[model samples]
Structures are given as C-alpha cells and as structure tokens.
Target: MTASNHPIVGILLLAAGKGTRFTAAGGEGNKLLALYPNSNGDQVPLLAFSLSQAVASGLPVRLVTRPDEMEIIAMAEQFGAAVTLVASSGSGETIAAGVCDSANWAGWLIAPADMGWLRSDDYVQVAAALSSDEAQARMMFDDMPGHPVGFGKGYGAALSQLTGDHGARQLLDDTKLVKLAGHSGVVKDADLPAQ
Candidate 1:
C-alpha cells in the first residue's frame, strides 16, 4: 500500500511568530513574504517555497498564522491546507493551534516557515519515519536536530499544551526519537541571507 492508503500524517507549518530577527535583518514585513529563489530558480515568497515543498510531499498540511496574515493564509488555503489563526505570536502557541487543527492525523510533522529550502523528499522521508513503529522522528543533519519533527499520537496532549517560543522541544525531548538523517538541506534554514 502506498502512503495515500495509510492514515494521514499532518505537516503543520508554524507561521505565526513575528520574525523579529529576520525583520531586523532587513527582511520586509513577515519574513515569510520575502521572495527567495527555489530549487527551480523561481522567485517565490519564503513561506510559499516551504508550503510548496510540503504540498509536493503528499501529506496533509495545517498552517498556524496570525489573524493579520491574510495573504499567507490565502496562499496556503490555495494549496488545500487548513488554516488556524493564532492570537499569540509565540512559536509554541502557533504549534499548538496547528496541532489542534490536525488532531485527526495519525502523526504530526512540525515544520517552521523560514526553513524554505527543504524539499518534498525531505518531508516524505520524515513522514515515512513517523509512519512506522517509532513513537517520533526528528530530522537531523550533521548531528543537529532540526525542523519537520514528527510526533506520534502519544504526544497529542503535551503538544496541545505547548505555549511559548519553545515549540515542540519539550515534547520531542521526552519522546524516543528516530533520527532521520538526511542531506544538509534538512538543516538549511533561511535565518540569514545567503552570501
């Protein structure tokens, strides 16, 4: 059976937090709105790049964003993604909203908005890891933990309780993680402009 036959593993995109660092670093409004080149050389919004990758991975997606982010929310909905407007700008709050919206999914793949370089293959691999007997899967590159972390059903309550800048750190640390090692792109976050 293919992945479509299995229970859906949600890809929750965290887009609510204000990108203070990114904004201070010269990025316009939401860091997500900035245009960046994609693997195909197309200039797309930063969040669009990541959302496109998640959509290509063949997984369900839920987006947690601020109420003011109508543009981003509209774009994500265009891809058939569920949108949850969050009141707080904290990473944890954003995640919990996404998680609650995706409560029906078999597992959860938590990804941030700024890590736009990740591709469909990365999302696919992480989903595969969470589909198995393992309770959780954390995407790792060069031995460093990164986004798109997968959480098994056991993490629902704890994940729902998350509410600060710390998204899923505590929940992930408490679970037995099946590290999905991959190319360095797994860790390529758009935190700073490429030189």
Candidate 2:
C-alpha cells in the first residue's frame, strides 16, 4: 500500500458540497457532522465513518472540505488523513484542487463524503486496479457507474483542468476504464437527513 507500489494512487474524499438537500430534509447541521449509531452502539459522525474506512485501506488519503468545516478537517487530521479546505463551490472545483495538491501522486481514488457505506474492500480493489499498468481508470457501481472512481496518472492533467460542477464522469467517458463488479452501496449517497 505504499506509493511505490501504487505510485499515483491516493484517496481523495470530497466533502465540500453545501448539502442543501440535507438542510431541506431538516438537517440543522453540516451533513458530514450528522451522527449515526454503529452496530457496536458507538455514535459516530457520518464523515468520520467514511474517513476511518479510507485510512484503514492503507492508502495516503486527503480530505477536501469547505473552510467552515474545521470540525471535519480536525477529525480527518485526527485519523491521520492529509486535509485540504477548498471553497464550497462545486464538486469540480473541489476535486480539481485536490488533484492539484496531490499532483505528485500517480492516481486518485475519489470518493464522496456522503458514501458512508462504502466497503473497505471496494476501495482496496479499486486501488489494486489503479496499481496495474493496464488500468487507466476504474469505476464501481451496482447496476450503473457510481462514486469512488479510480483514475490513473494518465488523467492527472485532465482532472486538474476540471471546473464548475462537472465531475470525473467526463474523464471516464474519454478514457479506457475498467469496471469492478457492482456493489449497491456504490450508488448509495446520504442525500437526506434519514439516509
């Protein structure tokens, strides 16, 4: 799991969204800070759960969030993830900044902060694929393409050039992407307060 084995592969957790939907769903706080109980009866904030998984995967991880989310930044740092506070403009801007900051990295495994259910194994698989010489990019999904896409070094410049709200989907369309077997959690995003 060292960068030498997977040179460009780094975990970038995108958490800069405004979470307007969650707010509309009666979430009075940052969606990333919303609490959810685990089976062990430990109450954890939604974002913390995701960050734990990323850290457990043994990859260098960077969390991108808004300036106001110092709580999330501190939490990520506590878990040993490198953190970057990007403007809460859109996914594209946040992602672009992350890619730039990790420019030395050979690839990126991008995940949304809301996908608290993403399995650690799924992340391992994507990173494994990115480590291979043939994989330019890899995507996971249940029945369709979903979040937590892995991009190789070949797409670095393109990813850094991204702007606005558009995500890496366009990069997937333009590159040779390898798809991992579907996992329903791949498409599940915490869009509402109850989710």
Score each candidate by Cα lDDT: 0.80, 0.81
Give the per-residue lDDT of model 2 (tens digit) for 93-116: 889989999988868899898888
For model 1, state the Cα shift of residue 60 in Å. 0.4
* Decoy 2 TM-score against native: 0.90
- Model 2 ranges with Cα > 4 A deviation: 1-8, 131-139
- Superposed by TM-score, candidate 1 places the C-alpha of residue 107 at a distance from the truth, in angstroms, of 0.8
- Measured on C-alpha atoms, candidate 2 has an lDDT of 0.81
How much RMSD separates candidate 2 from the native structure?
2.3
TM-score of each: 0.90, 0.90
Q: Which ten residues in a row have the lowest lDDT in candidate 2?
A: 133-142
Error of 1 at 162 (Å): 0.8
